[model samples]
Target: MTDGEGWFVVNACESRWRDDGTLGSYCTFEGKRRFPHFGININVLGPGEALGMYHRENAQEAFLVLAGECTLIVEGKRRPLATWDFFYCAPGTEHVIVATSEQNAIVLAVGARGRGVGGGVVYRVSKEAARHGASVERETTSSAEAYAEAHADLPRSRWVPYREGWLPSDR
Candidate 1:
C-alpha cells in the first residue's frame, strides 16, 4: 500500500512470502518491488532448518537474529546466536545460519547485490554446515551445482501468504 506521496510502506504481514518446506521461508520485500544496490529479506526457520547453502560472496552481507535462536556456521566455525545478536560478514566470509532453537526463528538478512567489480560467489563445504544440510559435497563456485537437487523431494520456494506469527505483535 502507498500513501499519496512518492514513498510507500509495507507491513511484513501484508507482504509476500517465499516458502520452501524443508529449508523454511522468507519475505524478500521484492515481489513487485525491485531493490537496487542491495537486497533484504526476513527469513523464518523452524528447528533444524537453514536458510541456504554454505557460501561466500564478494559482496558484503549481514544478519540480525530478531527472535528465537540460531547457530551461525562461518568459515567452518560454529557460534550460537540469540535474539538481537548481530552478525557481520565481510566480503568472502563463508557462512550460513541454522535454526537451533525449539521455536521458529526470525532472521533479518541484508546483502550487497550484483557481482560486478570483483563480485562473485563461491560455494564452500563445511562439516558444521553440512550437519545442518547446508553444505555442498565439494567446494564449487556454481550456485546451480550447489543447490540443484539440494532438496529434490521437498518443494522448491514459491510465493505464499505472509505468515503472521513472525511479527512482534503476534509473538
Candidate 2:
C-alpha cells in the first residue's frame, strides 16, 4: 500500500504467517500493489523463541519491542531489550533476537527494501555463538600502532571499513 494510504491498521490476529512461523502483516501496499517502497510489520513470537539469523541484502531495519523482553546480539554483544525498547541494525551487522519471557513477545519492525540505499541489516544469535557465529574483533591499539598495521603498499593511515548505508546522507 502507498505510505499515504491512510495508515492501514491491522490487529495482530488479522495478519498472515509464513510457513516458518512469522506473523507478517504488510503495509497497505504489499503484493496488493505492483511495486511498493518498502515493507513494515508487527511481529508476535511466543516465549522461549526467536527469529533466526538471516541477512537482508537490500534493506535496513529497526526492531522495537512493545511487550515482553528479548536479548539482542549485535556483532557479539548481548543486550537486553524490554517494552518500548529499540535497536537499529545496519546491513550486514549480523544479529539475532530471542524472546526470554514465558509470555509472548511483541515487536514492531520497520524496514525498507532497497540496496545499500536502504542500509545494512543483519542479526546475530543472542546466546548461541554457534548459531550466531563469529564476531568482529575490537583491539586496543595506539594510533602509531594502528598506522603501522596498514599495508606497506597503502598510505600509512587507519581507516575503518566502510559499510555502504549506515548513516543518513544528510547526517
Q: Which pairs clash in the backbone of model 1?
A: none
Tens-digit lDDT track of model 1 for 69-154? 99999989999999999999999898999999999999999998986754498888899898999999998877667887576777
How close is every model to the real structure, measured as TM-score? 0.90, 0.55
Off by over 4 Å in 1: 1-6, 117-119
Cα lDDT for residue 24, candidate 2: 15
- Please list the residue runs of candidate 2 whose C-alpha ends up more than 4 Å from where it truly belongs after superposition: 1-12, 22-35, 54-58, 116-171
Local accuracy by lDDT, each model: 0.84, 0.49
TM-score of decoy 1: 0.90
Q: Residue 105 of model 1: what lDDT? A: 92
